[model samples]
Target: MKQKRSRYIIGIDLGTTNSAIAYMDTRKNPTGGADAIRTFSVPQLVAEGEVKEREGLPSFLYLSTGQDLPVGSLDLAWAKERNFAVGEFARIQGAKVPGRLVSSAKSWLCHQGVDRKAPILPWGSDMEELSKCSPVDASALYMGHVRDAWNYLMAGSDPSDRFEEQDVILTVPASFDAVARELTLDAAGKAGITRITLVEEPQAAFYYWITDNEENWSGIVGPGKIILVCDIGGGTTDFTLIRVREGDAAPTPERIAVGEHLLLGGDNMDLALARLVESRILGEKENRLDSLRWLILASLCRNAKEKILSGGDVQQVGINLPGRGKGIVAGTLSDSINMEDIEQTVINGFLPDTRFDETPVRGRGSGICEWGLPFVADPVIPRHLAAFLKKHAAEQMDSSRADGRFPLRPDAIFFNGGVFTPRIIRKRISAMLSNWFSHDTDPAFQPLVLENNSPALAVARGATYYGMVRRGRGVRIVGGCARSYYVKVAENRAALEPGQITAACVIPRGMEEGEEMEIEAPEFKVL
Candidate 1:
């Protein structure tokens, strides 16, 4: 008889564009060592009739007709006869037919104005022709895939072992509100995940960095060092400011600040490229692209942008368009995304060299638009980062050091998410940031850019490290609540006025997880 596998601690990063899972066997690292961290090559269907294990599972979900695919083509170890694909195949096929693809469910998860529980994905798809899933349901499906992959990988070795029984750490965006967090928990339950601890994505990324520099984390990031975590993912760009302070035993890391959750990221870049392509293609002909055609073009531009960005030496990335009614080839309407396009749109447009005081400008309010994910109108990333720093500068640092010119400054920076995979992007941001810090007195002020390997898989790996730390093994970041929780109280006893409502902080910043707090204030009626 074979020896049964031991229980494992798993980490799941349910990202916007891609999702991943990592695990650590308790038997291998009985003491919860840092070397015990390893990720699962998620087994997913890459093609119509092919399945392969890959580093990260694409979050795109494809709703297919029951008769469209052959038997077992869409089958996984734990699922069979599924009329949908949830990984690599989903992304590839969905790009070709945009009407059936459910993308950016994570973004929709936080759209409180809209009904997240409603089955309205595949945004503008004809329901009679294509299947539909709710944003919550879509998220649950991705998590379900991760859970099933883990169980199948540990099949016969541990009959009693299951993901729901283990210590599982799931990561969410730091800016997710109460409703969104509760909905995430609900999704976990739907995915058969019984026991789980929610960790913020930015915090998870920091944990991975700490694990990477385990031996010298204390020495490297000493006391008073402010580490900025710039997490620009496929769908959103998040910033977390972690300040290291000298503890009784070792240096403790605390999440001092978290920026506003902006719907600005690689998706914006893809859309920008798509518009450029559309303009160039339409200018050559008198015909305009319909909604369906425009969606297809956007998908094509996204693929082209990725290829062009990844290919450092390559000058241009060509996109092939499907043939129209006139006599033409499928590749006739193809467009090329050149290096100049990337530098102009991404580097200059998104990551401009802006002043520390400059913030993103809100545009004039417009009439009601289509019911979709609310994205930031402005695409300037540096301005947003600067604005976030400016907001926390006065509170985080001493007023004496806070001159009018330089309000907030970070000692170190850690880049995370698939958006930072390209070296050009990393270099551009670093150079621009360093330039911002350069002043009259401090001409040589340069913030350290911490080296990170496998940016695509860092969050998932870090989440596993966080899980290990939770088990009382490695050095942990003592970060509590990133932001304070507040409750509103109406001032006027009669009619509500403009300045009637005032918010009282309940869970203050840096409040540790699992710690309870009691609000001590004047008696107020619960409305």
Candidate 2:
């Protein structure tokens, strides 16, 4: 007798700082129960000969010298030895030599000016002797590691349990442009993920919400209600607004708008803290931090910041700053992240409460600009939020949307990222949102209502559920691409005509992808 084929769904969260994989067996849960979803504990080396399993894989890669290690030192159970290291060991050890560490490759993928496929990562570093890789290559390495982990889990269990046989859902930032998305898809392809689909990270988070709430989701959310997903990862902050649409059976979620790509998040905060500590150390002296030492200190600041934010009841943290010598610790620099520091640095500086009409202010332009990642000059998060809402909620899009009202605001907010681990930041953002909502009515309403319990792993979980939904099992979010796409319309007019070159929107808001549209216009030379 022939054996029945096992069907499984895999979800991969390709994050900026950390990545994770989750899987579910449709064969086990034919009824589409959320409990079927389980996280895959990825096997990676935490230290030399100390292999351990972690829930999420740190999205980092370390170029190895291959001198001080034995054969198979960098090999996983399913993967052979490679010159580079990934996960915990890569993150922990790479901190000591940041020049070799390839971090924030996801951010680099979105940069337009740089050649993504070229080996230019570990950008602007003086690691000339060592080999460097492209952003796409870095992403593929992480995905390849996750793929190996999945295959390793199913190796002895079932012959048909290969990742190639399963449907995969890969999550990306909602703000990622077309090129970035394409690069991510290509990266997954290179990583041996055959059957895959790309879902926005914010949408994946909301899908997790749906799975978590289950039958109760319909009760909590109704038609016409908007939910804002605020995703602040290690490298970028993404905001996506999803509106609850009318449905016959259940309320369908439709993504209405996505925020601008802001290269400001936990990494920026870490850099700020590093600068603060550096100033304290130098005390306005002529001495400045060298590149290597500055890199090490930045890594330390990241670690210390995590401790201060997540470590409850821990008043202070200390870092043994390294000096210019072999195996030498200069001094133990201890500092407390006081409430005032948090307020002044993060709340006031990054997310200051602003009115709906307000927008982010541009700084003075410089003559000579540094060539690197494009960071947001203005740190005010509210102003960016306001701008996104205003831009998408314009009355012009009313013809394409179910709700015609301008200045649309979300009824609930979903927070996802390590930065939101502290209750203080969440509360501050909630207060700012409420202040914006207060302008509409006499009695103020709190718009930030939805709270995600598993902020760290929600994207992976939601993506797993999304894979199930793709197989016609669970509830599906209805919106396709969030933004309206347009093609430039060229007109045959005289010179100096302002309306000669216009744009014709080919894809309307909420239109599902792969839906073909025929545009009726005067045929000009296709540009």
Candidate 3:
């Protein structure tokens, strides 16, 4: 029996802080070009009883109490009688009530320390009798909301045009391990998206670049050029290196290395700014903020940071904190943050300029540490990049060196994620990289910046192009498994004595998809 092809190919970028959707209609452009892709504006609840369309849906969920809103205020166009909300309204209202909000669910989904399936989100909250959801459930709810939004706007009365019935591709971090990838698939399944494929977010960004410059991509990036994809989003920072190969007709890109999963990004910067604002508000007072108040202040700081870094004429944004008193207007606290605060806290503190040999500082660990997401101790992003380059130096070395001791130098850099949206931030990073390379290897070597049209939404659009590439329509980046698979084996020893355990590599790194290998090891006797 012959099966009918899907009408549309959809791409979903399930980011840590935001999510977006893009699709291509196969009937309109059968050959598939970058111009055929279209971004879908999601319709979500912006406020109580108010619905609005936004390009990116904030990845946040708010569990509403019985008295949170008026009757029938949480109703959407597709569904009614809702007790919870997921989208802009959730982010806005959840800021006030942090105990019931579920933010950074994507980061929690990949956290192996906690049970991802257990209802433990809103971590470290003291509100009792409050309904809670697992990380997997929160992620599923976000995806489910995206599916419903697409169906409501695009599907209409035609069942065949439903989002779930179309071909879909989802993007994940290149550094996500096997367990995290499995949980992402589980979340998608729970959202009723049965048929789907997973593409690394870094690869998707590169795909978008290729799609956007399909005509002169070869001229922009030629063979022997190594492009580094630096993706720093709200909750995670991902790095991937792609080397261009000399093909007969066109230049081919191959993924060389991927950095470790480092849970550091704009969220850390928000916390830093919050602390700065807190010091200003409480000025020399010993009285400290409770957990709930601290969370509220942090949310307000995030808003301020965004406004200041948005490259607008506004130099300062006012932040107000609700008082603990019975009256709403009495005892309210207020403060303002200017551009200097952002420069000192986010730019100088998080992304400071350092030498290429400098590495991230590791603080001494205590025996008993807090149980939560394992964020990087040192927040300096350039130091981490230096360390990553040092680790992967053996992969691609500078041929100019006689002894071949020089590190891998990137010919160009492609920046993605919301953190790089600010021009100052991008300029600082570019200057730092150029300084490092020019001082060490060549005097005139400068990395070319591959301009991205939409830094925040590139992953989703790139994922859509990747879907077309899967159908043998566009250029494909040859990236298989990012990491290698290993197994622990015990050395030959007496049964009474302890055996020496060693890690044995079963599958080498960069193993292509659908490739298989058989392990040849001696069987050990069970003691």
Candidate 4:
């Protein structure tokens, strides 16, 4: 028996807040080209019993109580008698019933302290009747939905065209550790996608930029130039620095550094806006809102934030919180969020001007702590960026700088993520970067912005292009392990102290895939 050839190469962007799929027909494009790649519109339940197509699927899952909707409302063409929902409808309905909603699964998947395989999602929920799932389970559900949707729309009656049989590339955060990466692979395997390759989200975004500018990318970026990839998504912020060096044919790009995983992004901004509105509506003396009500308010604030930052003419959006009793309309609490509130709360709060040497302030931890997803102590994005640059300055510093006093200054910035959709927000971040550089060395130095055609879809599209590149199609960015590894060694003595253990570098940073290195360490004898 012979194996069937894959008809397509697919890329999946399993984002924290939303997910997207892109693919290229191998049969159609024997010789791959960036123009041949296309985005797939996913069919999902938009409302009860109604199915519609959307470009991106919201990464939220709602576990139904079997009484929330009408019969056959949750049914899909691929499955029947369903008790759960994923995508747009899930996000919309879960906002009202926060106890049953599984959100930020990606963030929880990377959390080290918690058992990712344990059923602890909908964290801190007290609902006994509702079913709970693990962080890995939530991710697998999302991936399985994409697989079913693809088979239903593209496979037709041909079993060979199923998504599981295709060459797939999935994107993950660059800062994710080995445990997190392994968990992600487990989720994909559970979804029936065993043949898959994982790519860093930041690198995928850079690949998309290269494919988008294949004609003139070499002209725009020459040798010895550093490009900073700033990725601020719904639930996480990632920073990567890439350097362009001269190659045999054209300039080659190499990834030099990646920042630590910081759980701070649009979700944090939404919560901040919600708190601002809550304070205005309920006075300081009023009782605080319960957990359910707080989640509902945050959802409403998310909608308002999108509207205000959408570059529309609307100045404000109204928020109406439903009461728990029968007379809901009469007991409803109402408030409005204006453009001013958005600017003061989200823009000024997260992305503010700061000096290059200034570090992010770490808040004091309480004696009694709670077990949950570990969020960043400081929410200032600029401060975090400054710290990332300072840490990697020695390796990426320009040869012209002999003083070694200034941090690594990027020649250009490539912004990718939904958080950077608004022109005002992008300009604010650019201005902040420019201010920091001007104060450091050159007064006229300003990092150029590499225009992204679509920030929301870049990762998926880039992943697909990378799949093609693996098949001998396009240029590949040289990047491997994001961080170095170390092993603890004890001192050879008759009596050892508690503080005598030291770590030896086993694997150096930037070691490419498939590369081997010899470690010189004493061998231990087992009894």
Candidate 5:
């Protein structure tokens, strides 16, 4: 019997500690709103004792003395409760190398061979410590998640249904260089994702913001309007100047320029806070902060951070040390020195505007200088992004204002990314941008911004939108106005290695694949 083509579109947001997937609904077209981007965060993490069980059969798997019984997420979660799980619930803990565990998969994507090697952690784990698992290839590790995402979609889908044509659109940070983009696409392909288009995270966030506001991409974009997008995510923060021009077809939008800081994210902030906590509170007791323990503290500080920023002292919003049983701690944090402490933690740790043209923020190659986003900016990360964006922006924009690009500013800024949690980071982002653009002499340098519109999940949502647009299956905000050029695969190029660049292939003209136009050229292979 012949099989049918698959029609499923999978959107995945592979994050630091979590991963999620969403796609086009065969039953209902997700209204082109914030709601359209529905996803399952449970994709990357499975807690202990939470695995679904069948009524008649054994509820779990066994691998021990008598073939041990094991449940998925619940197993680890339960282990943590019972104190059986060690070093991050049986995962690696307290390793000097980020390579040991796949905590910063996206950051590793910035490297050559590393991007292909760093994404293998929860898939299989042993108590062998973090060092045994540390491999230099970040791309391979990342591929595991993409593969998992694809498998998840296939598993959840109806088996009796005929396979339908599905296209994939992957999202990544703006600072990603040619190598990173290639590696990301390669990873997607390895995971069974067929057709793909890489959209910058900030760009996807902008679409989400516009789609939410207008109900569709067509609503907000028409005639002459400027929409600036500033996406300060966990790993990287970027700014893009989008201009809606009414010259041809629909309101065509162009990406004028983009700015970002790689190392400035929530994680960066967390590290800073963690260190402070270690020095001021824990001090000599630092050794007690194991991986799992540190994770718990980071989680608590993150939870209370936003509340503290909002001028509210959290109720029961405090640290939890599993072994120590410190469930939660609270102080006169809101009214007293709490907010000040938090503010100082962020302001001082990040170095704000004062950090330009120096250290991680400056003189780095493409794709962010620091992987540490200010969200938890201690122990800084492998990538520092802001300086990368600013440098690129300076090169592309004429800050002198002599050229039309001089005013290079976005109309309305959109912020979304996996790292944009706790919501307080949004405020921190606005403050940073105020400093970034204020240094400019041009009157048009002002940027309009919005905060956390499903920050972590925006890319997955936009990917679904992009897939539909590409396949002509659903309506997207990319109505009459879209990129004038057709969505063509990169052209003839040599066989690309893990992170090598193969040229872009052009789609035949006149054949809009549900996008602006169809492939006009003969279907030629890119590899």
Candidate 6:
């Protein structure tokens, strides 16, 4: 027998608007340990035209007629056309053909008062009509994505592949809330993932930072130090300050705590810009005609966003607003809407250019007009931007020490998020960081500890790399969360059962991580 090899650790980057998964196989490096890990990432978007109801795929499946499926990539049959809309309950929704859809259910898990499993996608209502889904039926939705990825890997397995050794580490935003984390763990379980862990997005990036020190940063943290991690992505922003240290005891680099601002991200910026286009192009006429008009609007938002990213101004917004009394709204999307209008829509209404805490910042004019409706001038949009920036600054400060603690700064942030990629956005963020650490003088505070080098894949790469570390370490104890389940030991075999303890973990909670504490299982059987 050519002994089957146990292998692979899957890392999922589940963002607000986009998501991806990367894994490592031992074949990459036999001599090196965890450092030999490799990675691959694809947008979590499923296109309708290529949908196919396969084993791991979600419903609304599409197949590319007769084409061989692209195994480790997004089925981009409809990527060229995508739009964002205010769904049924005014929630921002994106349109997808039959099986083509993208979701970041990870972000919705933290809504206050509302059930995390409730229909929370922006267009939950309208989509309910389209898919004839229940008001709160998200079970078959995003969960299907997990299945899809798992199945994708399984399908590629050879007869000699030993899946028993495969493990998974899920990267969640550092700021994930209680219910949000719960729901995500639920989703992971639903995906049939038996060995899964949730690592803060920033922390995962840190592993990458530690791995590629010298080239990416000034120096690595000497064993113990405090570090701040800021990750801005498509749908939200996550920030955390952590202490970094290495040990194989059981998932080292203790995650002190993480904080986040719900619904703050580049996607929001896109939304504001989209709305600005709608206001300028449609103006006073939006009460008429609507067939493929929705589709056209989607295209406009995508185009306008691209224009801004390209370092150029868009003159006209091509929308399909028919019968709206607005003369050129439907017919003309070419170079017609006057670049001035687009500029104001962004600069004045969407994301107003402004200053924060005496530090200057920039926002797309498109963001200004889109976010600031009835769009007033004289510090209109800038005020909103200022509030957001200030809120983040305050949150970071509040989370810095966490009750009289000099946790020590991290060697480097190990930064990786969508916002870090765009050249313009990167520069803007750099300026903001300049202001953020202007006061720290510990010589430990990294001036600008970030990894713009490999923005999106950083987290996935770190995770995949780390997975290689546990190859022969036996069954390791991944962090535990509520409503979560792991195989229980019985009959000398593992049995499936949900976690029992609800009180903020006992033994583990009471003693220092390195110190072991005896625990007596308290039972209160629910009737």
Candidate 3 regions exceeding 4 Å error are 1-5, 325-330, 364-371, 398-405, 487-499, 502-506, 516-527
Q: Where does candidate 5 have its weakest 10-residue lDDT segment?
A: 54-63
lDDT of 1 by residue, 1-527 (tens): 83333378788889889888888888767876557878789899999778899998899899987766787788876787888999999998887777788998898898867799999998877658676889999999998888888778874566567766677788898888778888998999999986788898888898888888888987888998899999999888899998898899888887888888888778777777777887787675655565556667777877777777785667787877775554322235877888899888778878877776676888731211332667786788888888898788878876756656777788889999888988888887888778888888888888899888768777878888887777677877776876677887656656766556777888887788779977778566755
lDDT score of residue 342 within candidate 1: 82
What shift in Å separates residue 305 of candidate 3 from its native position after superposition?
1.0
Which structure among the candidates has the greatest TM-score?
4
lDDT of 5: 0.45
Can you tell me which runs of candidate 6 are displaced by over 4 Å? 1-5, 27-35, 40-104, 113-129, 132-165, 214-226, 243-257, 285-299, 310-414, 436-446, 469-527
All candidates' lDDT scores? 0.81, 0.78, 0.86, 0.86, 0.45, 0.45
Worst 10 residues of 6 by lDDT: 84-93
Over 33-102, each residue of candidate 6 has an lDDT whose tens digit, in order, gives 3446555422234332333322111112121212223342333332333221111111111232312132
Question: Of the candidates numbered 2 and 5, which has the greater lDDT value?
Answer: 2
Root-mean-square deviation of candidate 6 = 10.6
Clashing pairs in model 3, backbone N/Cα/C closer than 3 A = none
List residue ranges in candidate 1 displaced over 4 A.
1-6, 157-159, 284-287, 324-332, 364-371, 488-492, 495-499, 502-505, 520-527
Q: Which lDDT tens digits does candidate 4 get at residues 395-473?
A: 7677785345565778899999989998988898888888777754578778899999988899999999998888777
Candidates 1 and 2 compared by lDDT, better number: 1
Per-prediction TM-score to the true structure, in the order listed: 0.92, 0.89, 0.93, 0.93, 0.61, 0.61
Instruction: Candidate 5: list runs displaced more than 4 Å.
Output: 1-6, 26-46, 52-101, 112-165, 189-192, 215-226, 258-261, 282-337, 351-407, 418-425, 428-446, 450-452, 472-527
Per-residue lDDT of 423 in model 3: 89
Worst 10 residues of 3 by lDDT: 364-373
Tell me the TM-score of model 2: 0.89
